[model samples]
Target: MSPKYTLSLWICCCTLFISCSANQPSEERSDYPEADSLIQAALSEDLFTGAVLLIAESGEIVHHKAYGYATLYDESLRVVPSPDSTTTRHLFDLASLTKVFATTYAFMALHTDGKINPDAPVSQYLPDFNTPQHRTITVRQLLNHTSGLMPWYPLYYRAAGSDDLIKEILSLPLSGVPGEARRYSDLGFIVLAEIAESITGMSFDEYLYDRVYSRIGLEKTVYNPLDKGMEDLVSTSHGNPFERKMVYEPDFGYRIDVDPDSWRNWRTYTLRGEVSDGNAWHAAGGMAGHAGLFSTAEDLLLLLQAVINPVSGSNDPIFEEETIRMFTEPDEFGNGLGWAMEPSALHAETLPQGAIGHTGFTGTNFVADPNPDGGRIYILLTNRQHVGVDGAGLYPDLRELREKMAKLVFGEQLR
Candidate 1:
């Protein structure tokens, strides 16, 4: 379908929702005072510069709030954070969330359209994996991270361009036999991105937006926010010390050597609206399957709604409910196609099994409960990287915060 036609259809759907009582909000507002307190505490401690927290219960938005500042530091003037600029609509670099929101959706769309088979060997499309075992890696294995691929690599330093990057990813030796382990491999998703592009004969970003997100009515999610005329994004990272400095310096001509322990004389210019992931920004130009999609909390809710339930009555709905369920259902390893299954410490232990979500390195997460008894979705977006990479290592209490937020959202259900 054409972009124009899909947009018009989305507008019609929005109008329909607004006209009906389905758009009317519930009378009793969900209280999340503890959640608010946690955000304030995080901000005061400089753990996160800003965040957008969103909660959806039974398809209705209950809590949507923004906290702190988007662009906190001003290196030019050496001034402290100014919060007058923070807004709920600010775009955030959703680090690894790109796996589920973009790459997974693209894979699902191709499967639904009969353009690709989940069980087929990825080498069928991208034949660079010429070895016996490598050639046998199925699309399902890649999605479930059972492709025996390495978890990650310094692709930014290794590859000269996008083509070289994919080659570098394919050249990595298998960590184990495919389908034997549950290693979460970014390399697999990188290959999956290539598979999607190879199948559709389009760029990964183009295929993702044109084929998946646009059809599902996501207007704010994008691959390269700055390139697409979007400013006002949550800040992340101080500078690319690893890739840009250690590998290719003049852009980041502030470091002498690659030392994870060294801290003095480090470049501290905050990354505002720029991707923090070295592989995605430096190698892929802010477009990659493993990372580098920017989106707002509200934009994500649209995609979550489609995932939590079926998108019915539309001619070009992105994927069938059955397809979504199939993809989200846990495999033998307790891993979904792209989602991280719940009963995780990320959510309340009392919540039923089968809750699913993914977390980003930039302190962003979204989780949804599949059980009908407590059907809810929660999104927490934080630019925790604003304090730089070392900050994340130093303050590794994010899991604690997530657990608290989950408990607050789930309320007395945990009791």
Candidate 2:
């Protein structure tokens, strides 16, 4: 054959190979197509404004995809989101995941350092936590959500600030005796944060950064994202309308109302770069144990990856293997220390029996096995509440979208 003809033939062969490879299902995408499809479906339904979905298996990232808009509007301009207009780098309110990432990790540090006892009563460190009913609430009980504290109270409405809030929480009566039952409680983690402060002589955010984040290679994870000038942060809710109504409306009698959803007045202003949880923002001033922490999905996945591998993967391990085990192990309620274990909705329908994870109220969640060898991690971060709480009321099934995502990822392995 002539030299030109041979070169042309080689070029044609290369083009055909490229086309075939492009059409082939990626080996890296085992269950990712189903998972990505689920995310797209959720985005189409406006289940969330935007999301950063990441999946890793056997210590390698198999999938990392960003979707939808970081913000649908700019001031007054309704901008259509594209790759240039939107990014996965936007910070999201981690909400309750702060329990594990900040509060729980702080406690684990305190426990490892012998600075605090897990079994010790809260009163041991905080003697003013001397409410008769709360004297028996141990640190372990708080960590495990067995402290019998209510899941939440509108302390932001009742108290002027953190000082008064702590006073109110310490004095509040327990709904049940300590260790009698497991009830997931923000109040418990708030108290845990307080306990951490009492022990370290530093604020929660300061202590968390010094002890956990600063050392863990998590530079972007932070509290008070607005203070850090993170203006592009993913927006949540329309100015906490439900909370404003509960706090401000005179018909509610200027008291903490029991039913949050059954209220009259609601705010319409957009809540961007603000902590969505009322108590965390208003009462604690955007620094709390249970909520307030904000981070990117990439930052969170770094932390999660460390938690899974713990030993040699990161330059500094977040926790020792034993401590990690203790935290991820199942409790009576199938909740791990700060993490949720098997049978929790966060773990999806049919994940491995020992998979552990946690979900944030702001549509953030990460479920991981952390077995090192065959471990899998799935993370979804979105500003779902941006559509307003009322949207969920109209579209009640919207909340189940995470579980559906999990089911899709796990496929037939889900129980």
Candidate 3:
């Protein structure tokens, strides 16, 4: 089948499944007028081109709504178009969610089966990491971003070629003593990828696909969309801020447009059938502990449901109950394994103390509150980066929309 036809068929199948499931109605179908109103307001304000917002309570999908066009073009600059409907299944560059979906989850599975010890020195897996300073870095430190490795060091720049990337990464200097402090580091996850590979004797992507995604029925989630016949569902964008236009580096090729001024030619570099992150693309978009994974809002919700009910439909939990607790619990820095713990000012009232979730740099955010009687999950996916790359305030607007929806659903002030 053609890539476009495959995606169209997948979207149609999911939509039909949802419609059939909804007709059978359970606890999830309870009226949520306020939630509906909030989503309507967001769509009316043009905050999102298209979104699939679902709310579940007591193991039921109570609210599911799709809005906006799958594709919306800007006449002045000819920006990449957005998806027209929730069923359209636009590809979302998962950004840091890779930390959880790719890295943390992998480790959890390994740790659960006794394949790895969190406190063991990383050198045990990757022997090249035997430098005195490196020998002390434990798997636990890497999981918590306290590995003392610099947050990131542009391995793409240091490595002479793709084959040398791992060598260059192994030679990086430690930024601090391992386990001394918490500093979110992409490099940490990159190293974790190497460790996972060494221990499993399989590619990182293979391990995740066969173990995690397939088990959860996450058909649309994968390390790289290009590999999975997802050429059509992918979204494209310009660099942020609209000032720093994208520039092609000889080594890294095309950048993802994180600065301003790139918005005008955003479509020129529209990454429809490619990975957006230069590092991931250069690495061929396989599993990376740091980034790389494309999925839609509905697929993500399925993953979250698995997180909530780890033992449901599967005997093996994605994370041990303890590990899941650690991923959701806040550290001294208020960040968990791959998620942010604290609520923004906008949703502080609605978000409980133990609420856990993550935000993708590409205008995607999800929050799951496990407050038992009143817990709710909110997912908002957009391509605000499509408008401008360097823009920093887009999240606040997204948060406000989520707050509004929460307030409407719960019938109280969420902020």
Candidate 4:
């Protein structure tokens, strides 16, 4: 499909949702006071600067609202005077949620087109992955994060450019035997994206927009929102301070294998409409498999609805029903293909076993229960980085608030 035609499809999708009574909503009249209060308290306590929350019960939007300030910090990272407020339309960087929404979707399209085999060694597409250890890695192992790749590596310092970043990642030693352990790895997804690009001959973000997201009626999901002419995005991070500390501070939880002074081009201004991830921005230029996608709460809800609530007995544009099942149905490893299942670290233990979702580093989350009896979707997006890090020099972790909200959203179907 041409970009022009896909844009028209996006316009129709946006208009159809806006014209519906269920899409545009006022939460004051809804019964989610508990969730509202939980978010409100977090904002009051400065957990984040702004947020957009959306909840869908059985495909009907029950609550959708924006709260707090969108552009909270100034260039020097200080709280601004009269911070700009946010609307539901403002985009927040989805961070690692890109793994499932962007990269996984592209993989599904490739699978449908008979371009990729889940069981095939990645060397089939990426020739550099032909090493004895790397040769044993399969696409499925990467999806389930069983590839035993180390969780992170700062390829930004080592890569000459995007072309060389993949080579740098492939040079790293595996953390464990492939398919034997379930350590989630951003490097694994970055390699997965390289495989997708190698196979499709398009940038990762372009592939998603052309083949998956736009085709599924998503108008706002994108890799670099500012480059696409989007303004007034939710702010994230003051320069790259937290990530900078991560590099120099050896005891910082995530291992950084590069020298602290290896890279000198650190960003020094507050981030808006730019990806917050170091590798995504510095290495991939806002188009990495692990992070960089930005989106709105409602656009994300529509994405969830596309696969979870497709038209009955119709040829779904994105993937076949069996394909969706392949990714959502958890194996004994406690995870679906690229998605995290319930009881995993990504969700509350109270959630039913079949619930599927993912979380982003920039304080974003989306989870949906596709069960006929428990059809519900909950999304919470907050700009936790806008307020900068706390005494520990880290962005406020949204996991506590995420768990609280998930419990309330799925209270009726808690396992």
TM-score of each: 0.82, 0.83, 0.75, 0.90
Per-candidate RMSD, Å:
10.4, 10.0, 7.9, 8.6
Candidate 4 regions with alpha-carbon error over 4 angstroms? 1-31, 312-315, 372-374
Candidate 4 yields a Cα-based lDDT of 0.80
- Pick by TM-score: which candidate is best? 4
Candidate lDDT values, in order: 0.72, 0.72, 0.62, 0.80
Comparison by TM-score, 1 against 3, better one: 1
Q: Model 3 reaches what TM-score against the true structure?
A: 0.75
Instruction: Write the residue-wise lDDT of candidate 2 on 1-415 in tens digits.
Output: 8543453343334322322343222332333777766766676555665677778777677776666655653332233243122355668888898998889889878876779878888899998866667778898999998999877777764677888877888656676778988877999999999999999999988988888787777878988887887766777776665556545565643355445544433435566777888889878988999999998766877777667777765565767777777877888788788887755547366577678788888888888776777777788888777645552232113447767766655654444
Instruction: Summarize candidate 1's per-residue lDDT along 269-327 as a digit string, tens digits.
Output: 76766677877776787788889899988889888766676554466567876788889
Across 148-186, the per-residue lDDT of candidate 4 in tens digits comes to: 888987788898778997688778888999988798999
Question: Model 2: residues >4 Å from true position, as ranges?
Answer: 1-31, 73-84, 244-268, 314-316, 345-347, 391-399, 412-415
Q: Residue 253's C-alpha lDDT in candidate 4? A: 78
Better of 1 and 2 by TM-score: 2
What does the lDDT read for residue 401 in candidate 3?
70
RMSD of 4: 8.6
